[model samples]
Target: MVDFEKEAIIENLSKVINTKLTEKANKFVTADVREFGFIGDGLVSDTAAVQKALDYCESLGGGEVIFPKKQKVKLSKAGYRSIWTWNTKTKLNRAYALLIPSNVTVNFNECELIANNEGADVINLIENKNASVDLTKDSNIEIKNVTINQSIDIDTFAYNSMDSCAVCFQNIDGLVLDNVKVLNTYGYGMRIIKASNIEFRNKIQIDKCLGCNIRLGWQTFIVDKVNINLLVCSDSSNRLTANAVQGNTLHMNACSDFVIKEFRQTTSNPNKYVGSVNINNNCSNVYLGKVYSIDTGFKIQDYSSDGSNQPYNIVIEDMYTEGILDRPLFYIMGEGTKINNLRCKNIGHFWINNGKYTQFGRAILEKSSFVVKGNLPKEVHFDKLYLYNSSAAFQSNGGQDVVTIKDLTIKWDETTNTGSYLKLLDIQCKFMNIGSIVHKLEGSMKDGGNQKGGILSCSTENTLTKIGNIIDQNGVKTENVVVTLSTGMSTMINLAASNIWRDSWLNVLDVELVPVDLTSSIVIYNSFIADTNGQSLKINHSKAKGMEQFRLIVKGYKHIKE
Candidate 1:
């Protein structure tokens, strides 16, 4: 067995990187596009010249294909066509400017490629014809420091041709994208599918992509290890008029073992349907380090059937979101997920549904709430949760085994206008242990709405002493507690009737007497347990002293649920 946390998975992934592609492109034979009849005068069509140069490099068994850095490369859609056929007999005719071969490096050398409106993708990755469709994976391909402008007028572009992109990678291995900037793409900026061992380095900037800025493996094969650094997604208009659009900053499906160091989504007006970072289908083992989102949030869900391919083992650290007041900041529905250090400005919710061993630790939500829904597994823990000026709403469906919170704190700085902040609804758990709660809200906690069964043990300071029936230290469903009562001659302490299993019996563990206003030494013999029942305890004094205050202590046990 391999320990993924202890071992350097990035280093092991680096071992599979094809460094020989760069070595051969830089240190070996090279073919400049100008030498192969490419005139960079910005008037003639350079598509044929670039293709000839690529063919010349492939003939040399793998070499460098370079364009001039001083001049601009203009590719026109003359007669080059690529056809993609679907299972439903739908054909898509795309005009790709150039086709790249394997075992070669194309260095634009910071030169920009101005593509025409009909040119779908600036460079072709996979061959999609009728009889000669290429499903074979391309090896050792690297494109670096290139800027591409599809120059598609979004108003006139065909909506059925939404598959257009700046670069598309399908069935490829060992690819690297360095300092790639794509502007005003009609469709996706980059579409990656069935590709492995890829590295997106330096800065990847995509502006005004009507579709998702970067799309990976949507209804396609499984992808692996797509590590990115310093990603930036922005829309110039801040809105899109396309009716059919995947309006997400980054959407991934069926991808695994990926790490994104940093991501920034600057679109002020994002679509309401999708999230900023949408991880759908069966993506697992993903680590998102830091995210700064505006007007959007994050979502992780598994759309598989019969629980066969549920996503698991995901982690997100240090997330800051704003302008998402109607939806939750983190909408999670998977197992073994952890979110830490979440700080949000406006009020939102954190929704958790149908998961096991999930944790939300060390979160400072100023005006946000936590909501638990649907059926959950046995072990779900929330540790170090702090809420300020927000409601604590935990809603459960039914029949949850256990949910534990280590340290829960709720505080308010205002002195007025505080309503019911703690609302627990329909919580049916066997053992829900919330350890050490400090609540400073104004009103009392609303009663648990229609709880079915089980115990909720919460230690509090001022607002509420207990939320549900108390469970003792030895895993017993006992309401045995020590409370201080000040009464005159006799007082009745009502026992919570929620201890339904042991309602027929009662026991007095110990008794202590303490006088408040008298100088006389009050002893235990002076007081006596006048009467006791399954629902109440009555303690009385032997002497007929009118309105004399004294203290009482008691303890007991009940049946334990196995």
Candidate 2:
């Protein structure tokens, strides 16, 4: 026999849960699009009838508009992809477009909204006639389980709606687009302008478009609090030679305070990347998480007129790339950008920063094997940059700012086409404080191998191997120049040696230990003079310490450099 009290309590709990779930079932007055006159036959101009249904659903103070299963849609309008012409010859009708306004839910039922529409997008929401839109938090629209097909070429496509986008939004405060596929669009796959507090999630795919797959926030639009993730974009490497801009996967122009997660884009050919992902035009406070690319990973810049607009406060983490085919994996032309956990291979430039900033920092670069080249800037905050098979590292050129590296590690590869191991030129004007650097060089010292790491003199302009080759190329003494850590300040180095080549690691950063020559037994000065005129500032090391408390301050100098 069942326990009566226990069974009765379980039944009561089930009843309460069912009541709560029932509240979520079809909250809106649901009706099929066919009921309002859409044939879904793929030939008829079902524009007027479907639009009528949407208008009625909106009038119901927010209801559901359902599209029948196995629907084939083809609606025709004049000048499908033409620019706006207001003359009597070509009258535009943006109202007849598949417009979904505030407080409505659309369920496509896994149906195809086919590309039979001409002149405008097959679907639109809250069209703003002007370039600018004013939005608020009171209204919303939701769409799910739909494929927007724009099966037309530029010859048949027209710039319809507020944006020339096949799926467009303007002045929208709330929108949820889930499980949507935009295919073969003559223009942009989807365009969002002047929006705030929106969420785009769950399997959004776009393939083969003339322009960007998605364009977010026009230059004149004020946008924020937008979260987009799980977006897959591919070019198919099938763009015509006559294409323009090659169509970035997603473009964010002049947007602010956005978060992008789990976005992966791939091109058909690694060499045929046409401006893959662009986030430019004064975008700030942006974060990219779990992003990967085959072509150009990301390009962040500001091309506003007069060069006043610049991007700032950007953070990208957990980006794994095949490296870049044509561009840098991360090209930052802004300020206050932080990157973490970046993994790449032998493709192209890992990162290229061509802007000005007060301070820049990169955190946790792990599991990467490639060679990269770039300038080291001032106030760099980096930690645990473990590089394997690295061909070349940073060009430690002296700039106005003194760069203090936190921790850098280089693991050598014997197959690497060896270049300069380290480039710390003496032209550096400011003091560079490197915390900890671990270099592991591979291969034998005999047979003219490991023949690299050239450090030259500013006076003689010849290779100076004062600090005998740190690694063996072939057993032969390498004529290639070694490190010249000569700075304006004496006793500025505080480095702790990790695992190195051999006993040749003696005079690494020592004032008393002498530097040895590679080919000869010549002993270079522990601290050399700057000029032949002997008009140089000198200092004496009175204390021994570490870099955590190392400080170098140069103030009120007499004659400046020539």
Q: Which candidate is the best by TM-score?
A: 1
- Give the alpha-carbon lDDT of every model: 0.58, 0.51
Clashes of each: 0, 20
Encode model 2's per-residue lDDT on 1-562: one tens digit a residue. 1111323323443454334323332347776788888888877867667667767877777678888786776655422222222222453434224666567777888877664543334433223223124234234677788887767563334443333456776666666777889877644677777766666668899876756788787666656666666888876322542544236788887686666777888876555544467778777777776787766466666575333565776666677666544343555555555666666664455443434342333433332322212243333345545555443233333334333445555554454443544332221323334454455555421235554542211221111112212333323432221233333324322221212222211212212332333321222233422232323323333332212122222111111223
Off by over 4 Å in 1: 1-8, 17-27, 39-44, 78-92, 119-134, 153-158, 236-244, 270-275, 324-329, 347-349, 376-379, 399-401, 413-431, 442-562
lDDT of 1 by residue, 1-562 (tens): 1112313444544455434323333233688988999887767768789888877877777777888885677777645454432212454555566666777778888877777544344333222112112456666677778887766544344554434666677666667778888876655676777777777889888776656677777555667876778788765331353555565667788887777778877664445323366777788777777888766666777665444455677777777776554453566776667777777655465666565556667777666656666654435666776666554544445535466667766654444433433332223345555554555433232233332211222221112122222233222333333333434555555545423222322232234555554532351224333233446656654443345444433332221231
Model 2 TM: 0.66
Q: What are the models' TM-scores?
A: 0.72, 0.66
Give the Å shift of residue 291 in candidate 2: 1.0
Error of 1 at 257 (Å): 1.8
Instruction: Give the top-scoring candidate (lDDT).
Output: 1
Clashing pairs in 1: none
